[model samples]
Target: MGISVTHKKLKVELVGFRLSTPKHYKIDGVENIDIERYDHEIFSKYLSILLEQENVEIKKKIDNCSITLLDYSENEISSYAFGKLLVFKSGKRQRIVNEDDLTEGEFKNRDQGLKNEIHFVINKTTGVILVERDYEKIFKASLLNSFFYHNKNFIYDYVDEFNKLNYNKETKTSIEIHKNKLIYINPLPSQDLFDELEEFARIKRFKVTKKVEKKKNHGIDGCAKELEDILNKASNTSLGQNVVSIEYYMDERGKGLEMDSLKKMIQNIYQSHYYEDFIITGTNIDNDLKTLTKDNITKRFEFKIPVDIDGNYVDICILFDKLLFLIQEYIEEHFDLDDYYSDKVRNLIVNP
Candidate 1:
């Protein structure tokens, strides 16, 4: 028999973040520590606290998992760390049958272990942390928090231009087309007026007629005091019952919102008039959501590295070497590290 090995590529995503030091932290005369000052000792101390037994146990949907830093390296410009994540599942009883021998055996009561890996690099000069996208989720559970607490002298500010999508600050214009608009009766007519209308209708056998006496001008503004009593009665009551359908157009291309403030606004406008959808053609709604993409951003901060699939035993050292090589080549060829880092620093100062 011959043996065959298969290799698959796992795409690794790299993200960037800038460092900050909160203004209040300066009250005690403490300044943000430069990343270049983060030598082996400082990083080791932070990692030690992050890897504490209690800190490593993270809760997942189906099982409890532990993450441990397995290997690491550091240089003047960058620092790297790789870790293993193991998920522990309680064993369930299993039945094994031998068809040829007509015998059966039961196995139970053991723990099954599943594993994954996470790795990241910190660019000292840029204050950017590069990490794998999927692994980034695991770090969020506790490791990243603990790391930040232990290293409080510096704060991580997500300054990537694409990250603007997170704060809902992009400009956009919305065009709303209203249907079946209803006129609100001002002054709501008086009780005596209603009684007279009822009597007149009854005498006329409820036939539609223009001969009935009508109320005077009574503009909505002049009748505001009389309508105040009914405002509460009319609130949130399917305000848009007459709206057959709603269509929207954005100045910029984007996806339709299934459930959001817009839908709530529509309902309010239709039912209680709690909100109003104005038809302002040729105007921008500041901070309205605009989709973010590589095409829209000034520069891309993330890069992808494809790795070979090797089950739970992928070598961290080799992976680290590959990442370093790719990053170095990328910097040499296309990336302007200093320029990008300066831009992120400026953005952080402005937004912070």
Candidate 2:
């Protein structure tokens, strides 16, 4: 069981909030989401819903309580996961598309306008409000119990609010909560949030296939195979050095000094030098020489080419792919690492 939280008179300062109105585009079977677009109508609609859910009457004076968040990242992921009160400024409108003029600039101009975006500053759930001043510390700090920080903890639109009171004198086990403007309602789900994100990210990840394929088993795998090989080699090396290396060589992995050694291993695989040394790949050495390099790596890791440079043929982009692919393919099928690689305790990672 976890420790029960206790709170005193939880004071609050309503900051501001902003909602994304992305210009969605599906280009070449990929999403191109543009979160910079400031849709006043969408923001107004979401605000209306939030206010209704809160059930608190917005006094005439506090009607303009919406304060644009002065500082935060405009990243698509950050907007959905953690909330923002991004303020956009109307710069020079550059292009016109589908009858709407696309403006090029919306960089934060606090002194330029009244509130364009509204991000709130509240200290109720989280001890420190996600204000413009202390965003750096709050963003990196480990505050799981903090409501504003752990937005995904509860499925709600806004931070869940609650009031806690001291234990009643008559009842030892009962805690009383008699506070005003403290209890809040559940959050209303946003409209098609993930769908918008999928498209946005798809556009961002759209890749152009290069016509680099020459023939099958023609030494290098060509463009397509090179991309695949590159991905595999990069992943395998990262897994081995960053993850597997640590499991086996915890002392080296844990220390900040080991990053250079591990990084070189990853670079070796990336640059088609996986057979350079056992340190770069993994525990197996015999299979590496038989299947990939066809030569044993010496104790000093002497420089030697793994394949016939003249015999190998492929797109200039993937001339080295042959050596890297063979090295990677051989290891994937036989990935048994011994504890000998790491200078740690015996049997630390005999087989990973």
Q: Model 1 segments beyond 4 Å from truth?
A: 1-44, 48-72, 75-113, 133-143, 146-317, 326-352
Candidate 1 C-alpha error for residue 158, in Å:
24
| Predicted candidate 2 versus true structure: per-residue lDDT over 1-352, tens digit per residue | 8996432221111211122233333333443433222323222333334334322222112121222223222233221212344332332333333435554544434323333332332211111122221211121111211222122222133212211122223543221111111121111122222222222211101111221123333212322222443334331222222111111132333322133334333333323311212222222223221111111111110112222333222232232232234333333443333322342311121111
TM-scores for all predictions: 0.33, 0.16
lDDT of 1 at 101: 98
Model 2, residue 276: C-alpha shift (Å): 68
Top candidate, metric lDDT: 1
TM-score of 1: 0.33
Off by over 4 Å in 2: 1-81, 84-113, 120-126, 133-172, 181-352
Model 1: pairs clashing at backbone N, Cα or C within 3 Å: 238-271, 239-270, 239-271, 240-270, 240-271
